[model samples]
Target: MPHTTVLPFKALLLDMDGTLVNSDAVVERCWREWALEHGLDPAEALKVVHGRQGYATMAVLLPERPMELNHADNKVMLAKETADTEGVVPIGGAPAFMAAVADLPHALVTSADEKLAQARMGAAALPMPATRVTAELVGASKPDPEGFLKGAAELGFDPADCIVFEDSGAGIEAGKAAGMRVLGVGPRAAEHAPTAVVADLTQVRVVTDADGSTSLHVTV
Candidate 1:
């Protein structure tokens, strides 16, 4: 099949979880286990956990508990997640798509801490970018525009000139708030107000410009 031609953008901002890696099962499992252990509702827990940092999600779910306890449990859950990375898959075409843009200006913006992000990406065998804005790297998480803006800054590009590939509502909100165009990944992305939405990275194509620019053209 022919690759769709992406329009040129100054830089690319990528979301780590559902966008680049299929770690949803692992995430759901860990959170469900954590919710059960904490006497929280699993469905409610999943709703709160989907796009936020683990510690932050815990705080929301268990507000009465001490922050330290939440942190400890978060660590335990993260450890379990790290050890249980068995069925991780790269989102379709992610490996080659990443390779196609490897040399370009790009950065990963994720709610996961650097450790978890690295561990998950390592398990998926996805190439890590030099610039990444992780949970620990930002004082605030997505929907706040902090991480996305920071990523654009780290890539030395203005937010208006960057394009973001994201899968979650929070990520899309962040990108939009940061003044960047967003391409939503995965089926549920319609809920997020994205400039475009596709099933996976496989539906996206990298288009190069004569001026040495690149853009992600999506098929869905």
Candidate 2:
């Protein structure tokens, strides 16, 4: 038996990787190569990769590296990631969940730039939201809260009125920092203690009220 919980919000702020889409196959493949090139352990690099822009991840893994180098290398990594979407796919129940929120107030707040975001979403067969705050739009990455804050503002909702869906520590931290209730998705997010936790989107059901209010009935 599953204990269901209902969480209400005026808008949604969504994270792409590990949330709506599972790009781990491609992500791991690319990051592994990058880690080896930089003489860092691939396993350690992977531990810091999710929910961040490429440059941010690099900075974490290579704290002594120049910021400019990280930025320049991030461009190459982005191109490589964008060019390879061989294994990109939607998370469980993501397709239906997406449709349920299609008409709702939602914005994509992702670390990936527009091109990479499009490539991954297209590969996963997920519909891209019209309101998006991509990497280029944010001066900082996840764990900094800037992207989530901007997302809430763009959707005309206060942070407290927005619900974030994420699957990584950095994203969960960002959502929390922005004062939003976060619904953690997937294994990675469980460690972060989000407002709610779900194994996947299958555990979540979105409902729209007569007054146009939206609520997520989540089975933790």
Candidate 3:
């Protein structure tokens, strides 16, 4: 039997895409189209696309492009993504995990704006967390730590008292930068050096103490 790893925390911060919801199909469709339209390599663009807001991903792929232009393109891309939820679905064990934490101190911190976040989560049939830090709420994107920090603050927990669940390089880095322990959620998160990793939410069990503190029992 695999040993279980217990990680304690007062709050939880979750990333949407590639973590709670598997929106890879829609993500690939939108981004690949955008990349090809701009004469960039689709393969290369996708590497930096998983964990960032559209503008941030564009800035990385086209460093010479003006920030305003990236922002404009991001707006269009967000609309396209929001409108296409044809392939969105919950990650393995995500529905049960979300339900387990529904009344706990948890928040969704994603690169997606409010509408996109809602669309994807709704498409995946996952219940949305009441506290969330979306794109519009942050001045900077993941890998900058702004979103995670804001999520911790909104949940009334100190960074060290929070545990972040993520599946992207940028999201892992952002969680670490915010001083929270991170639980990487899938194949994509393996190389990111998260504090711990689980193949899926199936390998995880959430426990609430008599005092109401929460801890995750993860099978690594």
lDDT order of candidates, best first? 2, 3, 1
The regions of model 1 sitting more than 4 angstroms off are: 1-6, 64-66
Q: Estimated TM-score per prediction?
A: 0.91, 0.98, 0.98
Clashing pairs in 1: 6-217
What is the TM-score of candidate 3?
0.98
Best by lDDT: 2
Ranked by TM-score, the better of candidates 1 and 2 is 2
Pairs that clash in candidate 2: none
Instruction: Rank the models by TM-score, top first.
Output: 2, 3, 1
**lDDT score, candidate 3, position 144:** 88
Candidate 1: deviation at residue 96, Å? 1.2
lDDT of model 3 at position 183: 95
Residues 1-220, candidate 3, lDDT per residue (tens digit)?
7988899988999999999999999999999999999999999989999999999999999999999999999999999999999989999999999999988899999999999999999999999999999999999999989999999999888999999999999999999999999999999999989999988899999999898778899985
Q: Which ten residues in a row have the lowest lDDT in candidate 1?
A: 1-10
